[model samples]
Target chain A: MKKIIKPFWSYDVEQTEDWLQEMAEQGYILKKLHRASRTFYFEQAAPQNLSYRISFDRNQGPVLASRFLENGWTIAAASGKWQILQNSKPANEIKAAPVRQGVITHNRNVSFVFFGLLFYLLGVLLANLSTLVSSWLQDGTVAVEPSPLWAITYLFLALTLGAIGLAIYSIVKIKKSNQAMLQKESGIAAAKWKSSQPTLEIPESSGRFVKKAKLGWMYAPDRLESWLEKMEQQGYQLHHVGTIGTVFYFVKGEPRRMSYHAEYMSTVESSYFSIYEDAGWLKIFESWSAMEKWVIWCREYKEGEEKPRIYSEGSSHLKRARRMAGLYTVLFLPLLFIYAVNANREFQEFINEGAALSLFGLLPAIAFVLFLSFIYRMWAYYIRLRKNYSVFHR
Target chain B: MNADKVMKKYIPMTETAFYILLSLTEPRHGYGIVKHVEEISGTRLHLGSGTVYGTLTKMQKDGVITVFADEERKTLYEMTDLGKQLILAEIGRLKELHRNAVKYEGDFL
Candidate 1:
C-alpha cells in the first residue's frame, strides 16, 4: 500500500491568514511559517488558487495562496514575485535584521594581538634567562659549563626575529585604520555628487532610437554580468555602464541606481521603494515606469582621468594587511617561547659579563613592537566597522 | 521498474500513485523514478525534478518506502509492504470518492 505523503504548500499571497484559517477549518495543519516574509509551509489536501491574509501567533502578517496538483503542491518560483508581494496590500514586509556575528570578529582581533604579545614577551624572557645563566656559569655557581657563546647568540637571533615580526604586524594595523577613513570620506563625496546630479539625457541618433536601460548598483562585477545576461535575454539592452566600489550605474534614456547585494536582493528592492517614497518620486500609473525611476543615487563614471578606483583598491589592501599581520603574529609566538626555554649556558656566562647588552636590548624592543602590533589590530577593526557604518548609514 | 510485481501489496492504486510506486519498485533513484513514471504515464504528470526527490524522501520515512542497495551514491528507494498497503487503501478511498462524484445531477461539472 503506497501511503500518500502529503505535500506542504508554500506561497506568497495577499490573504495568507484567511487561507490558513480556511485550511485549518478543512483539517489542514500549518507546518512552518517564516516570520519575516509571512511565507509558510502547510500540510493539507491543497486547495485551489485561494489567497488570504493571515496573522501568525506573534501577530505578524503574511499573505498566502495555495493550490494542489495530482503530484503534490510545492513551491514553483520565488523570484521578483516574492518581494513584489509586500508592495500590494498590507504595506511593508517586517523581519528583524540578523544579529551581526561580532564575537568571531572580536576573537580574530584578540588572537592576532595575543599571539604577537606572547612571542615578544617569551623572546625577551629567554634573553634575560640566558644572560642570568651566563652570569651564574661565570661565577661557577651552576655546576656544568655553559654551552658555546654561538648557541646563546642563536637564541638571541630567534628572539630578534620574533620582535621584528611583531613590529611589522603593528605597522600594518595602523595603515589599515588610515585607509578605512580615506575610503569612507571618498564614499561620502561620491554620494553627494551623485545626489546633486540630474538624470542622463539620451543622446540623439539619426539612425535609430534605442530605449533599453540597465539601472542598478553593481556590487560584484562577475555577478552583475550574469544579471545583465538574464536581462538581455529578457530584451533589455545596455548603453553605458560604470562601477564605483560596490555601487554600479547603468544608463539608457534615464539613469537609476539600486543596491547590489547578492543574498539581500529582496531587502534592497524594498529599501529602494522606501527611498523612492521618501523622495516623492513614485508615479503609480506608469507602465514600465518601475524601470525608469531612480530609487537611490550613487556616482559611477565609466572613464575619468583619475577615478576613485584607487580608494577601493586601497581598501582591499588594508583588509589583506590586517589578515597577514594577524597570521604572522600567531606564527612568531611559539618560536620565541622555544628560544627562551633552550638558551645556551655559555651564552648565559657571556651575558653575565654584560657583553651581550646589545642583544639583550634588541630582544625586549622586538617584544614591545609585537605588543604594539596587537593593540593596532583592535584599532584597525574599530576603524573598519565605523567606516562601513558611516558609508551605509549616512 | 515493475510495479505490478513489487507493489502487489498496495494493489488498488491511482494511475499516478501506481506509476510513482512502480517506478520506485526497483532501486530507481528520484530521477530514475521520474523518467519511468513519465514513460508509463504517457508524459502527463511530468513531475518536476525537485518534486520527485521531495516525494521519495517523504515516502521512505513513512515506511511505505525503503532504500535499495547500490554502489552509486544516488539514494534509490523502493515501496515497502506497509507502503503498498497504504497505497491500496488510498486507491480504494479514491474509487469511492469517484463513485460519489459521478452521482451529481447538477451542471457543476
Candidate 2:
C-alpha cells in the first residue's frame, strides 16, 4: 500500500484524475481517499491503463446513466461532494460522460465565497488609504511610522489577499477545463497576435499609431464591438489596449472585414483564453477588473463567412443582461435612497421655514436624476436583449 | 400547472422535449428514457446522457413530471396530469401537421 498527500487536489479535479490514471499505469490503483481529501491510499496491482472522471453532485448522487455501468465504468472512490469513476477503456471510446455543468456550478459557487473575501479586503484597504490621505491633508502626518498593530493588520491583509487570490485562480482554472468538455467541435486554428498581453507600448516603426479613449465602453458591449469592427474596416487595425482598458491603439493597415466580440464573466479563468484562442478568435484585450471582467475578442473574416459567437445561445445573452441589470440596481439603490432623502430634507426646510434654497442643496436632486437614468438604462438594455430571445418561437 | 398554462409553455416544444415526455408515459429512469427514445425512433437519434439529464431536471421542475421512485441509485420519473395533457396537445398538433403535409405531398421534389 502507498499513501500520498495532495491537499489542493480538489482545486483541479481533471489533473487529479490524470494523476490517478498515471498511478494506475504504474501499478498503484487508488482504493480509498482520506476524509480530509488531502491523502490518497493505493494498493499494488498489475499495471493498467484506465480512464478516469471526477463528478460532483451536491444534494443527491451524481445523475449518470445506469448504462454507464454496463459500459464498464465503476465508482472507484467517493468522498464528500466528489466521486471518481474509472473504466477499462480510454476516454474517447466512452460515448456517455456525465454533464460537466454540475462541476462547473460547484466551482463557481466556491469562487463566489473567495470573491466576497477579496472584495472585503479591498474595501478595507481602500478605506485605510483614504483615511491616511485625509489625515495627512488636515494635520500633515503621513502615518509612515508603522505601529505594531498597523503592521500586523497590513501583513494579515496581504496574506489573506494572496491566499484568496490563489484560490480564485484555481477554481477558475478547473471550471474552464470542465467547460471545454461541455461541447466538442473541430478546433479552429488560433490566429497568433503580435502581443499576448495588451498594453500602451508600441514600436515607433510599426505604423502611424492612433490612440482612442473610450471610457465605460463595457456598459454597452455590442456598441463597443461594432465600433471596433468599423475601425478595422477603415484600415486602422487595433494594436492593443490601455492598462485599464480605457484606451485603444490602432495601427494603420489595409482595409479588411473583421468581427469583434466582447464577453463578460464573473471570474475569468486561464483556460478560458485558450478555448477562445483555439476557436480562431484573436484576443485584443482582457480588462483588469478584479471581480467582473470583460474580454475583447476579434477575428478577421470575409463578408459571407459565419460570424464567430462567444455567447452562442440567445437565452444566455438574456441571462447575462438580467444579471448585469440586477447587479447595478443593487449597487446603486442605497445611493439613490440617500440622495432622495437629502433632496426631500432640503425641500422641507425651504418650504416650512420660507428659507431660500442654497445652490449646494440642489446637488442631491441632480445626483438622484442621474442615478435614476442609469438604472433605467440598465433595464432598457435587458429588455433589448430579451426582445432577441425569440420568445414565441422557443 | 393547469392545462392551459402547460400547453402555452410547451405547445411549441423541441423534438427532444416531445420525445422525452412521450417516453415518460410509463415510469422510467434516466437510461431507460434514452433507450426507449432510441428504440421508438428506430435508432435515428442517439440522445446524449448529458442532454437527457438536463431535460429531465427542467421537466421535473415545471411540474410536467414527478419523481415516481428512488430505487437504489436511479430515480424513476412518471408523467403528471399536466404532462398527459401537454403530450396529448402536442400529439394533436403533430397530427394536424401530418395531415397538411400529406395533403400537399405533390409539392415535394
Please tell me which predicted candidate would have the highest TM-score against the true structure.
2
The root-mean-square deviation over C-alpha atoms between each candidate and the true structure, in angstroms, is 27.7, 9.8
**Alpha-carbon shift of residue A263 in model 1 (angstroms):** 11
Query: Candidate 2 on A1-394: residue-level lDDT in tens?
Result: 8999987676667788899999999999988878585888899999999877777765435444455665567888878877788889865566554434456567667767777776787787789779989999998977577567887877887897787677667657755654454222112222233344345566755656888999766567777888988898899888888878988888888887888877666644332443455445677787655456677888777778766555444554566667777887898899999999999999999999987888898899999998888788778767766775676346
Q: Which digits, one per residue and each the tens of the lDDT, describe model 1 over residues A257-295?
A: 322211111111221222222232221111111112222
Could you estimate the TM-score for every candidate?
0.23, 0.58
Chain A only, candidate 1, TM-score = 0.20
Q: What is the C-alpha interface RMSD of model 1?
A: 24.8
Cα deviation of A161, candidate 1, in Å:
25
Q: List runs of model 2 lying over 4 Å from the truth.
A: A1-5, A25-27, A34-39, A57-63, A66-71, A90-101, A121-207, A239-244, A257-320, A334-374, A383-394, B1-9, B14-92, B100-109
For model 1, the superposed segments whose C-alpha errors exceed 4 Å read: A1-394, B1-19, B71-74, B105-109
Backbone N/Cα/C clashes per model = 27, 0
